[model samples]
Target: MKKLSLLILSLGVLFSCQSASSKTEPENNPEIKMEENKTMQQDVTKKKNRIVVFETTMGKIKAELFEDKAPITTNNFITLTEKGYYNNLIFHRVIPNFMIQGGCPEGTGRGGPGYAIKDEFGPGLKHDKAGILSMANAGPNTGGSQFFITTVPTPWLDGKHAIFGQVIEGLDVVLKISEVERNKMDRPLKDVIMTKVYIVNE
Candidate 1:
């Protein structure tokens, strides 16, 4: 009878220890860890890139500013955008197979924010492809608020213009704007207005 009692107590202690061990075991689920890592990576990527959207009369054009490559130019653009500087402005110049130019407050491609930002020419930043966003200037170091987005690759403008961004979305809208009717001065016959322009920090 004593032997039976001893066996029962031993079995109880063993089961208790097994339960405690299982409860104390750390959770090392691989799927949960992978999901956590992916989320963190996405957050970091969003912080690194800055996007801007142009809600035009035609359609929305989204571009990613080259902040890492052209800090000064991007900063100037962000500041102006935050201040609604490009709102209600007209895309004065539209050249098919070339580019669409805008950001002129005068709606005649002759005005700016009353001050100029020094040209920022990052290495390899060139008008080498369609959708390239570049600063427009009459001469070197003369860029102010005026800018342009190319509809086709313009290699000749390299080194003479400050290429600060590229259209990531709405390239079709840019192309549509470029196809608009224009006068001899390249000014669009019907104004392609920028109804609103804003920045997206992602």
Candidate 2:
């Protein structure tokens, strides 16, 4: 009877040990829980803002695309950037106290990707200040790869152009290009090339 009692007690102890081990395993451990939370937070951070980095000859200009507000315009720009279409494009037009225009493959304000995108305008979007990025269109619904960044407040353009994005980090670079020497047509005397444009925060 004593031997039987001893065997039952040992079995109970073994079972208890396994239960404790299982409870403290990696899946249930506090350290693992913290790591999972950290990873989740990192992912959430990435989805908050969509960033685009433009590597220009003057300097790098980082713009935050308004994806929620201008989905078509923002995505179109993102697509062009991913396709390497803006590489080597010069800032073909730069008017002081106004804006700098580019993304013309011909560098003469006459070239585009051979196709135009519909205007994605909406309420509350306006070209009210510097750094505002909007399509350089010939008329209504004529948006294409060509875009401009304002160097000063341009309220007249408000409610006329589709304000798709803005210069979040390099407004100074845009203003600097606006000050470059230009001809009668406002084309830069020397090329202020956009070496590349790419999406960030992937």
Candidate 3:
């Protein structure tokens, strides 16, 4: 009878130890762990990238900035946008079926954000399509705040300018800007003001 009680105690201790071991070893409870992990991942927020939106007098020309390809140029533009640098700035140069250039605070072809940035041109991105946004520079590696959006394919500008982004949602707004009346300098007679150039995460 004593031996039977001893055996029962030993069995009870073994079973208790097994239960404690199972509780401590998370891998043994994969289903619970997986559910917890899923909950954790769901609780973690997804990253959101800002979409460059050109709110002009005509309409909102939404664009997706190519930060991956032109980090320097894109960062410069984003900083300028956050500072409201492009506000009230006119599209100083507009050529039908070609491009529309702006971002010069002076509203002249010769202005910038008081500094220059290196060109981000390469084989990765190019001026292959209309509504493509690119930095306007006097020469190589002289890019600043001044930029242009192609109204058509401009292959010649491929390696010359920093292709930073493209008009994803409002090409028509860009087309309208291209059609505005302009002077001999290609400066618009009527202000094609860029009311705002802002960003939206995601």
Candidate 4:
């Protein structure tokens, strides 16, 4: 009986040591570990989202384009940008330290892409600061080629418009444009033309 009990304890200890050894072994194959990590990181980054680069005549302006959250607004913007629709349009309205409106075919802040788009608004975005670029519209569900860049917070415009992107560079140029002399309605004394529009990889 004593011999049997000792043998059982030895077997239990051996099994326990084997389990502990297995616990110490690495599950991942070291040869492919780095490659797998890189692939996963890329997948996550691809879904992490990116912004659009608006190479303007004034300067290069980077904008965080909204796509996942604002599909319609983003699609419209992408369509226009891809087609070079914004080239040569002037920022017709310049309210100093307030907002700069454009996207008018006539560069008069009264034109569009000959069609309107539905408005998409929600949380996590606001017009409560400067350098914010948003879609310009006549009324609800009437947004099109028109868009504006804010120079100051316009809280009143929030929830009533769709913010497609925001300036990430050359805001000083925006400020300079804002300082342009204005007419009675705060429109620019002269046109702040966007001579060209091109894309850059984000």
Q: lDDT scores for all predictions? A: 0.93, 0.88, 0.86, 0.79
On residues 1-202, what C-alpha lDDT tens digit does candidate 4 reach at each position? 9999999999999999999999999897886998989999988777644566655456666677766678788888778877989888888887776877777888777778888888898558899888888988878999998888898899999889898777877778888887888889777776677777655546
Expressed as tens digits, the lDDT of each residue in 35-130 for candidate 1 is 999999988886686888999999999999998899999999999999999999999999999999999999888899999889889887889889
**Which of 3 and 4 is the better model by TM-score?**
3
Clash pairs, model 1 backbone: none
lDDT of 3 by residue, 123-189 (tens): 5787888989899999998998998899999999878888988888989988988989888988889
How should the candidates be ordered by lDDT, best one leading?
1, 2, 3, 4
Each model's TM-score?
0.78, 0.77, 0.80, 0.78
State the lDDT of candidate 2 residue by residue for 1-202, as single tens digits: 9999999999999999999998877665798889999999998886665888889999999888888798899888899999999988999999999999998888888888888888888567888789988889888888889999998889898766788888899888998999999999999999999988888874
Candidate 2's C-alpha runs over 4 A off are 1-47
RMSD of each: 5.4, 5.4, 3.5, 4.3
Kindly give the number of clashing pairs for every candidate.
Answer: 0, 0, 0, 0
Supply candidate 2's per-residue lDDT for 5. 100
What is the alpha-carbon lDDT for the whole of candidate 4? 0.79
After TM-score superposition, the amount by which residue 66's alpha carbon in candidate 4 deviates from its true location, in angstroms, is 2.4
Candidate 4 clash pair list: none
